[model samples]
Target chain A: MCVNMDLMATTLPLLDTAVAKCCAEPGSAPLDRDEADAVARLLKAVADPVRLQIISIVRCSEGGEVCACDLPSPLGLAQPTVSHHLKVLVDAGLLERERRGQWAWFSLVPERLELARRALGT
Target chain B: MCVNMDLMATTLPLLDTAVAKCCAEPGSAPLDRDEADAVARLLKAVADPVRLQIISIVRCSEGGEVCACDLPSPLGLAQPTVSHHLKVLVDAGLLERERRGQWAWFSLVPERLELARRALGT
Candidate 1:
């Protein structure tokens, strides 16, 4: 009855396993349900506007990193909102956050981005 | 008032412009607000799991692409749902769709992916 593999309420793990194997062995064969799902969840995390912008700004910053405290003003957004977005991006492995003094700084994780780029297989 | 450069609700276009120029010129230094915002939006598009899987499946396909009609069954999804996901990926310039005889075939756009890789500057 489900048209989208994503429609299945409990298919997350199955999809993730499928994608994990597929990404782990790119030249082997097509990705299974589990692997595909894992990769998707990661993507979904980065799919929101707020999260993406946070990533872009930090990536484009000098040294490809930014301090958590300096982020809110340029975006003209509330502190909590920006913090929430940063949390999402960092959790997804796309951005790496580190604590220094009383502030946290973020920078892009090139390996993760490279993994996505490689997924294109183009 | 804001902590993130992304705190501003109306800064979408500004970020977009900044990212466009930055991407258009990769060798350049840090991205401006508009450029970062734009890049973030594009990243936002591919951030969803369903969308990422669709791209992944198509990318892992035999010819680095896939036929729309042949996709749903493998992913255990429905037609309309899969179609919606494809539209998002295509709209983002990550995948290209072409009509041939009885179905649509989608292939990755390497150039776009390459641009993204360059954006990492790592």
Candidate 2:
């Protein structure tokens, strides 16, 4: 499951506090239980080669969204597998998908990527 | 198994080329086979709750390092479990571990984290 910053902050005050403080002044403290869980969920979503490529493809799409029909051939993955990875990314809040006609178009959620980058203090 | 940037660049020029070009100009293209594999390896390492906490703890340590003995208590995880996580991070090039007397010290690899951040264009 993807944990958004707002939900995480409200649901996990301790972790939210830690993340806020850490972001303001990094290397100040370790992530508490809830914080780690929230961050881990996001990281796990993008932890696979296929998923990473999917993100890259959608991110680089000319129209800012990629059609599901256009993905499998570039990565040499089957259509079903590509759809599965896209589902995982969408579930993790990293990508937004829209069904138009017979195609599913995916776009990158830059904020979520930024959150994970900040969590790693990158 | 963990994949390092250097090995990936040399072994998979197609992906390495994509990464180099992409890094120079963000969102220019998708990750080829090797680049995705290399990045996925690193992301997978930090994708777990315990491992993320461990990295956070070590990064925030006073001495720029933390002893293995000190991790379990703060994280509330079993010692063996913590060690296993540490090993995974080390293998992924995200953390470095050195045995000192009776304890193993772990430290964050900031450059590696930066590489990931750049990869995500965050």
Candidate 3:
């Protein structure tokens, strides 16, 4: 389902209230324009089919995390391309990385997902 | 933050479980590849700031619904452009549209949002 915003004004109140509650600091710093831009970039990062599919696959793997070594084979993508994508995800704070010998295992950071979810609300 | 799938291996289990539970069709069919693409497109649709902002504004508005007329002014975008974005959102099933008199108001469909959320899981 493609959800374009112009048709989604109704869900705005709850969505906005959710975002407002999360992003609006309580008597403290709030999300600035630049911050919003940054967050938007992050959202943009996973907005693609390939990226979204990767997320689903990783989450569906044996553990909540997966070794990068096993990735490219399934995707039929080049190792460098996968590495670049991983870097982007890492930069966004959406994933955390741990290097064990030759394997680099990356996993989801739930708080980041929660935070992004909140961004949607505001 | 932008969650690249390369880094979200961790959130996979929970996300996948959630999606499987919701969309696995009980004892029926499961999400196929084509379905995955469709859902991913919906996410891709809202990956941009312009569309995301429209969501925020519409949800943040009074009663969680906003008229098409009041949209362009805030974004400083042309009416047709705004209309196009709205059409995209509507097509994605994220936003629902209603026409009353001379105005066309669009609002968020929470179930659709929830469905997208589920898609993130599996």
Looking at model 2, the pairs that clash are none
* Candidate 2 residue-wise lDDT at B111: 79
User: On residues B12-99, what C-alpha lDDT tens digit does candidate 1 reach at each position?
Assistant: 4554454454443223444544465566666666656566667666666666768999878877889999998887677666678899
Cα lDDT for residue B7, model 1?
Answer: 40
A77, model 2: CA deviation in Å? Answer: 2.3
TM-score of the second chain for every model: 0.70, 0.78, 0.70
The TM-score values for the models, in the order shown, are 0.66, 0.82, 0.70
Q: What is candidate 2's CAPRI-style docking category based on DockQ?
A: medium
Task: Tell me the TM-score for chain B of model 3.
Answer: 0.70
Comparing 1 and 2 on DockQ, the stronger one: 2
Q: What TM-score quantifies how close candidate 2 is to the native fold?
A: 0.82
Clash totals in order: 53, 0, 28
Cα-based lDDT at residue A57, candidate 3? 58
What would the per-residue lDDT of candidate 3 be over residues A1-122, giving only the tens digit for each residue?
Answer: 12423423443344344445434422433333344454566566665555655565566655667788887876668888888877767666667889999889988876666655566543
lDDT of 3 by residue, B1-122 (tens): 13433423444344444456323322333333444555556566666666766776666565778899998877768999999888878766678899999989999877666655555542
At residue B34, what lDDT does model 1 achieve?
49
Error at B67, model 1, angstroms: 2.4
Q: In model 1, what lDDT does residue A61 have? A: 69
How far off is residue A64 in model 1, in Å?
6.1
The lDDT of model 2 is: 0.73
lDDT of 2 by residue, B1-122 (tens): 33554654454444335445334333476777777887777678777888877877777777778999998899998999888888788766678778899998888888777766666664
